[model samples]
Target: MDRAQRLAYNQPTWLDTVAAWLLALLWILPLAYAVWTAFHPTEYSTRFTLLAPLTLDNFSRAWEAAPFARYFLNTALLVAMILAVQLVLATLAAYAFARYEFRGKNVAFALVLVQLMIMPDILLVENYKTMSQLGLVDTLVAIGLPYFASAFAIFLLRQTFLGIPKELDEAARVEGATAMQTLWRVYVPLARPVYTAFALVSVSFHWNNFLWPLIVTNSVKARPLTVGLQVFSSVDQGVDWSIITAATLMTSAPLLIGFLLFQRQFVQSFMRAGIK
Candidate 1:
């Protein structure tokens, strides 16, 4: 090609560059606004002035307005407990579906998958009644019980297991290994990326989950960050945007810090799971 043609081909389109910047700003603007509002004093949040003096007063006031420390602890406990149960349940379920040839397997798997189509919040009434019947209402265990077996987690892990070569199982069999042994030694290690990806997603989901926890947990002993933030937000006659934003930031900080600290691993796990 001639130099003129090559020069034209190499030139970047201004529209494309402008679009990229605009898209970046679109995604970043909300986070920027939250941080800005969180740092400002209560009186300045609704103001458009960028140069407004910042203060720690909003965060201090937000902290004092609610039992945020207890909320954080509860949320962390709930997430950890649910994830622990889910990991074991999903692993066993996926192993059965992947390795066993039981009658009606497909039908059973289909029923599990049907749970995914039904929004979890839709079952709240029935679940609440069940909890009441079991006398487990207003407990952290009740908050975590409904999610013990995750359809999505089972499906993800099953797909990961199916991706492994059948020869691995055969090889383990030649060495006198049982199905469970092979699964533990060969499949679990290979599926670590999927587990990590699912763990991160699950933790984020349960951490932010509100309605179920709100309905089940009546006291500070089991109430989570979302419910706590609501209490803080509604304390004033008119909601103070600055204090609410500060509370929100505080509530989200742990997950935000977790993602930041494990960002590379998180990205790699998701990418690996996607590729599989």
Candidate 2:
């Protein structure tokens, strides 16, 4: 290409780069401030100064002020339970949708896809009513039962399954493997990358979910870290920025550390999952 055409293309590329950086900075500003305020004293929260003293007192106070240990355990259990069930259900459902040609299969798959367009929050009232009827209200099961069957997970896994070659499935069956055995030894093993990617997304989402958990859980026993953080930040006296920021950091530290440690694998999984 001539210099003039090359310059024209490079100009838009440069502009896109600048715009991306600007958006990234805007996104990171609040997190940067939270890190700053969490480590510094209350007086330095709003006032930015290089010589401000750092301390761990805010974290200690926040920890002592709430049942964060319980909240952490609750959140961990909730995420683990949801992820486990989702993986099992999604794997089975996706395999059926991808490989089986049963009656009404198209209609059933269409209904599943419909859920991708509907918002989960819109079903909160119905879910709550069902939970009440089941006598599971105000329990961790109630908070998680509504989300055990994830439409997105089913869809992603189905797409990944569909991309797998039929030769592998036939080979497994030719070796006298039952249908379930073929699925277990062939499809499930091949879809590991997609499974990992979906697990990360699921864990991150449930860890940060606040509204439904807040509504379903009434006490500290079932309250996740998000709700606990909310209660800790809202007291009768006033908002304590330093303590709140420290608590926020403490609550988010696990996810942050996990992402930082596995970001390369995370990106690779997503890329492989997206190939189909």
TM-scores of all predicted structures: 0.89, 0.94
Number of backbone collisions per candidate, in order? 0, 0
Q: What are the per-residue Cα lDDT tens digits for candidate 1 across 26-142?
A: 988988888889988766776869688978988888899898888888888999999999999999999999888999999999999998999988999999999999999888999
Candidate 1: give the clashing pairs. none
User: Which regions of candidate 2 deviate over 4 angstroms?
Assistant: 1-12
Q: Indicate the worst ten consecutive residues by lDDT in candidate 2.
A: 6-15
Error of 1 at 232 (Å): 2.3
Against the unseen true structure, what C-alpha lDDT does each candidate score? 0.89, 0.92
Superposing every Cα of model 1 onto the true structure, what RMSD results? Answer: 3.9
Question: Model 2: per-residue lDDT, tens digit, 84-137?
Answer: 999999999999999999999999999999998999899889888899999998
